[model samples]
Target: MVSIIFVDESFRSGRVCWIKDIVVAVTAENMEAMRSIIQRYRHKRISLAEAGATRHRSIFNGLKALAEDQPDVVIIHDAVRPFVEEDILLRVVTAAKEHGAAGAIRPLVSTVISPSADGCLEHSLDRAKHRASEMPQAFLFDVIYKAYQQCSDYDFEFGTECLQLALKYSHTKAKLVEGPPDLWKVTYKRDLLAARSVIKEKISQEICVVMNTKDEESAGHLLKEVLKKELNCVNVTSTVLDHTGGNVQKFPTDQCYSFICVNVVSSEFQETQKFLSTLEESGLPLLYPVVVVLVHCCDLTLAPLASKMESLMWIRSLAEDMKKRNVLLSGLLLNYSKDEQKLQESFQQGASIIAALVKERSSALAGQLLLA
Candidate 1:
């Protein structure tokens, strides 16, 4: 099933304060699975409605189930299209409240042609003059519910478009609003791959760098600056992890999936352990694989390379343990230097590695260590 992220932006306007509920219509065979998945979001009011054989029936049933709630507006969306933005939803709902109905539309990509009875093309439509209807449609609750109540059996069995029902039965012409390119639906095997790639790209765009307050001018801060240059398009944020890990608690709530814990003051993994504990306590990793790159920066002149590596070798076992909880833990050892040029070179190398680990998010390198 496609996972949809619902962001409530309705607080910005008085028309819609919050999403009252989310109704998912699914087949009987998939009802248990859907319920199991929906249970994860205890904070949201989500329920499942029994789906019918036809698409129109499924939608009508969903709307009928919500009639008792007497909501001001109803937003209908396809579960297959998970990339719908919050702004599009808000616009549709606001427009529906004013115009009685509203839906998203995109410019037709190819010319839609009419075929004759003999299966040959009879005529072609002007693609520039027509638009492709998309999901995230909205309507005034009474208008859509009454339309479904009055629709015929033939329409319920064969009809696919809900906007047409509102126009034909309720006399409500739906307002067509333009949508973005990412509103495409997942329909094929290749589309699943594309959706996964898009999701990974979206989650990797933000990185949170956690370090101790004592290392403000240390290699950790330098690496943070270099990372900003390496991943120019990504949002890089740095937070100080105090003894209580108070400041580091906000990253998970901010939906930051990538993290780099810079341990510059100690050879042991005390800072990294504290950071991981905070993340575990939040239970954010249970939803998605959290990319955690533990960076140990030290000046090799003061410590032997063998002893330093042996001290941190325990991270490999810890990484394996964290991976069980959906946390992708990896280690980076950066040889800190006193020379200006040497330090900059080392930080650049570490920055590139961190960027790759965050972007790919491969499980294969979960317990491995990379040296720079």
Candidate 2:
């Protein structure tokens, strides 16, 4: 919510990279993982602290460790809820500043029941009257810290609610904010699988560019130059692959989030198809959505735009087929102008749209074309 950075702690498999400062609290057994992640981030705002055995104790320990930093507000989040959004975080923080404590809640989906000693249902709770408390809870720094100090050992060992603790010790009534459906925590094995899929979709940021040959005058080469500035150069790579099914040499070894294929003519998509074939055969595991942007460059002053539009229609059909494999296909018609200034402006705009497609990890433009 504030302009800070938060990086994910790599445990078994998942990864997260966000913009916020972070203090990771882990159990003593997970100290090794914490050290490895801290080493990777290497930032002054990022630090580590040991957690206690129980949930409330762990949170208290984390707050105690942060006494020196003296943050204005402290937000407590569970690592399992990977889909916490920026808007929800902002809501909790603002409410906490106004009300001293705040937490997220979702409408209960099922009725809760209590069983008798003989195993028969004794009572049933009205689902409409209850809500499920979710995470990304926030509190005023001083309010929560002092509340923890006043907590009894029994509360520390058995208490599960931070808002209740604040209310009991600091007399602070917590504000409840409704959160989105994606705020569910990963509590089971199947939940982890869902989290993995969500992570793959949102974290696809790396991109690669493919061109037909080594010609500097080619459209792909010129576009790649502009893209390098729009995206991180380390995440963008360029290489040559011939149209006659030749191997694509000199590409990045790591996974690519998107592929930009540049072609001078509208009908020449064989090289792009061959590149896709090679990718399928390489056997490298692709867990994220991969975008394939087809950029067709032609001088619009010399050729009629109507004639070129027909050749690009094939892309729509091809895109529909590629969707089955989780591949998105989009087309960009770079209608170059004879005027140097107009051509330069068009190139800049084209680069921006391509960069947006990659960064947003969006498929809104799939099976569609833009005239740049």
Candidate 3:
């Protein structure tokens, strides 16, 4: 699924914004499914149009549905290009309002060569002069709608460029706006992995650490302090995980995807399982992978390493099950020391491990337990 996150940095309450409504155009067979998926993310009503067989036809159908609204400007975006930024959207919309049409452009990576009839390279176009046309294009609604109305069958069948139609029918030249590198579309299997990595990095910026006990002197609190130092760039917050998980519920599910569950007095996986349950009930993992690092601080004088490992071996199985739900659960065993210096060192090491897990968010280390 193509996941999109819309951000308006200049948004203000009670102020008019360029985006009035969002509409998704999909095949008739997938309309209902798309509606359900959109409803999960957006509570407000979003219009859905039945798409046509071809690219231009689908866009034409979407435009036809907006005829009644008669919006001043219409922005066209490819669902696969989920990394589109708000700056590009604003620039295109503003340019389109003035120039009648506008579209994003990127520098071409390779030379465009023309092949001869015998399959040999006949000529090559100057790559420096040409730019790749990209999505997040905008047009005057009336101008594009009229252009589509006059489209021939061949145009709907094979024509992919919307700017060309505007220029051909309305004689409107599109203002080309340069876009960022992240505007590239997800087209291959490797692109899917890249998309996930980008999404993971975006969501990993904030981490909510949950402590099972309310004690200020608990090992969880110390870990939280070290985490703050280690992940200085990250926004980290700590809260006591009560029976109802009220504090955790206070955190907006959309903002944070990484969680550190500190189990000091309780049994291993008890607090982590509770946090995971709250996350599961909220359906946050459905949007992206939720990283939950289960941290257990053990005093070797009290609990032997072999016994602790044996008791916590069940986490491997639980991690496997949670992985299916997009919850990456990992365990960290920290050797507790009475000396302040040694304890601080252990906390620092544990914080480093947590930072790596949260940043990379690799599923390969989900079920493994790391010692600090």
lDDT of each: 0.78, 0.73, 0.78
- Every candidate's CA RMSD: 4.4, 11.9, 5.3
TM agreement with the true structure for every prediction: 0.90, 0.57, 0.81
Q: Report clash pairs, candidate 2.
A: 4-19, 4-20, 5-19, 5-20, 5-21, 6-20, 206-257
* Rank by TM-score (best first): 1, 3, 2
Find the candidate with the highest TM-score and give its number. Answer: 1
Residues 194-294 of candidate 3 have per-residue lDDT tens digits of 98888778888998888767788888888888889898888988777674434556555667889887773335456456667778998888767888887
**Model 3 misplacement above 4 A:** 1-18, 39-44, 212-218, 228-233, 240-248, 267-277, 309-326, 339-345, 360-370
Which ten residues in a row are the worst by lDDT in model 1? 1-10
RMSD of 3: 5.3
Candidate 3 lDDT: 0.78
Task: Indicate the TM-score of model 3.
Answer: 0.81
For candidate 2, write residues 231-286 as lDDT tens digits: 65436678786755666745653567678887735556675666665655553324
Give the worst 10-residue stretch by lDDT in candidate 2: 4-13
Please count the clashing residue pairs in each candidate, in the order shown: 0, 7, 0
Task: List, residue by residue over 151-220, the lDDT tens digit for candidate 1.
Answer: 9999998887889999999999999999988778788999999989988988888998877665568666
